[model samples]
Target: MTPPLEITPLPYHEDPLGYFAVLRDRPGAVLLDSGRPTAPGGRYDILSCDPLALLEVDGAGRVHGDPALAGLSPFAAQQALLDRLSREVPESDLPFLGGLIGYWSYDLGQRLEPVAGQARPAVTLPASRVGLYDWALIQDHDRRESWLVGSAARRDEVLAWLSAAARPAEAFRLTAPFAAELSREEYLARFHAVQAYIRAGDCYQINLAQRFSAPYAGDLWAAYRRLRKATPTPYAGYQAWTGPEGERAILSLSPERFLECRDGRVETRPIKGTRPRGATPTEDRRLAAELEASLKDRAENVMITDLLRNDLGRVCRPGSVRVPTLCGLESYANVHHLVSVITGELAADKRPMDLLAAAFPGGSITGAPKVRAMQIIDELEPSRRSAYCGSLGYVDVRGRMDTSIAIRSVVAEAGRLHLWGGGGLVADSKGDEEYAETLDKIRHLMNALATPTNDDKWNKKDLHLVDRDIDIQ
Candidate 1:
């Protein structure tokens, strides 16, 4: 009998900024999903509530948070970084995701000059064909093909910092505004292009999106109350937190899952398909049941699940793979979705980097086969997806980690903002209704982005999925 996969067991030491500082020095990748040095001593802890850490990675499509190697933002630096991160998606073919500023801006159309002396890469040059399996980067500690810091020195330093980091604040302050949006015309044009591009590429599926607004500026607590009362989602919650510099928000809601790594195991739950909740309980159940029974939807769920399972397989012990469930219907405040759970035990030898390497650019966000799907997304979407598909989570000094898929999330640039929302398109998807579904995803964000709506001009942008309708005139 074959011996079960014996992961030689990896020996790891911790540091708050240990190996990360080294990663910062490497070329061409945006650091998404930054791990924070928690309070009480700057201990390594997850800061999923940090608005800044929520920013995503666009590195080679392995979307991790670009750790905040710098300071805070006063404006819409969100989408700007995402666009920068989006550049990484294309380079996976070149097998590189680097050269980033990871900065956000407030004035629309602001541009960042490349750092002096940085190599200006030629676009669309030298293409090589590495064997399918050959192109994947193998991430072993010695292969330390990337940054690999050594010793337990970094771990000890973090505990010391955490011990020193305590102070109480009266209340939080906003360095800048969070709610923002884009114009209707620009959104429509972009959506139209996405529709055309996806079809031209013969993409079996693509998720297209747009932005909306009518910012409801109230206190974070008040906003939380309204959002929860006005709209409820399974993934939505109110989290209150203060960072090193001090800022906080209600964080109204989030409907995606990133990554969850515990004792000796790791798992990623990808959410693929979605439907709106109903007024009546009977209607709600039917919606969930229909999603479960949906052939097109279930197929979409399976494709991502298979892709995730494959990713987990790379970092897990042999025979440790299992899909405990599939196409399970999960309902949320604004939407109902089909979720699949895939789990595995990590090879004692595997590192956090190994887990991420096996599953960069989550399967749920990108379609399958993942590579081709990403290529299609590049061609379909209007701009680079800086953080939309990346992840946000916390990693401790001990290497325990948890991350969420960046979905139902917004990225800002200047006061002009960019956010995306879309559903899986299958053979049965309608041309126009799919467009409406994207709008549904944008509904809450729109309300949050623009000025409060006592004015008569504000109209609820209702989309009719059945008739393939959009109510944006």
Candidate 2:
């Protein structure tokens, strides 16, 4: 029998970073942050550390975690193992009490479908990872309250860990400013390739991207703080785990929600079009309005929305899938996006994992006619998207789940920081405009990292740019 969880009240802090700072050094510490302090319309923040069990899938579609489940399929192994640990705990209104929290790499889609052997696996990592946790600290920002959700014994253990003085960590800095792997000629060549494909009726829209990497040292957590300050998002999260190559971390500041399933109701908000926020308020409104009214942007948004509706329909009850909002204007700190909301009800026999499997990499990121677009993406892109377009969130024991599209995020591993910027390209998309949009998406993030955290100034000598020509195609 599993121990039931108990909810205990604690001092509400607007920022959850202080509590996370205490547990960060511990193995498997994860924070699903709702950017309430800076982003509008965030409600809850969930924090947890030290999972009971871990499940990871490698690039070859091999499952690695429990010895007994070595031969099982990735999704099947997750369902079986997670089902065993999920017991009847005390009911709570919080989104996540204790369950699996981690990331599903965009490359993981290769396992679900037969789209492979095109893109080079430049960044090696697990296709998917999740940790089974027995305890969590949940904060409801709307109510201005905090609670520790876990067994009585676990509560005491966590409280003691949180009470201990936090350890000092060195300030993080980029040894070299970020540099692009793809040059202008390379991007234009790919852009024309995508347009050619679209003209041939191979795909409607394809999301193309370029990678930027910078060598860095010191505490990645400090860098994450700097990033969140620069671009706070409602679906932000931080998760770190020990991989084959030492410690790897995901620092996410995303504005798009991939999927949310609660009480059998499913919802997905897909962001398609983007325009950088203007320097002034009047300019900002003009950019936002322009995004809302652009026919090209609206068409892109509608195509992805229809694709997501079909995705949800695969695992949802018949006649339950619908799109309530289309091409809705959403203004963020750095850009204005045209977002669409799609809703559905999960079938009685379906589980959250099934829903996730049906919509793994998300339609918005992959474009219309999902699998075909992914093939084209693989054929053109130089490197595998390790976690850029993947989903990052949690699946609790109670069947509630929420995930964010892993954009505006960075992956830190092996003394290198990897960032990606991309946009959906349509038939009418201009090469110059599409090229500029790709850089516009992540320019603020790079600028933020270049800025110093405290009194320590960046040495100008260390900030030299390095550009490499990648001819992967």
Best by TM-score: 2
Residues 336-377 of candidate 2 have per-residue lDDT tens digits of 999899999999999898999999889989987899999999
lDDT string, candidate 1, 1-473, tens digits: 11111111123323212322222222221222211211111122111110213442122212233444223221123323323322112211111111111221111101111112121111111110000000111122222222212113322333333345333212221222322232444445655654565567645555544333221222343443343344433233223333342322223234565566776677778887777777899998888888778888888788788888888988899889888978777666567878888889989997554575457667777666665656555544434454455554433323455555656554322222334566666556664666667766656654544324444243333211112212221
- TM-scores, all models, native as reference: 0.55, 0.96
Error of 1 at 50 (Å): 11
Q: Roughly what TM-score does model 1 have, to 2 decimal places?
A: 0.55
Lowest lDDT sum, 10 consecutive residues, model 2, at 464-473
Error of 1 at 20 (Å): 26
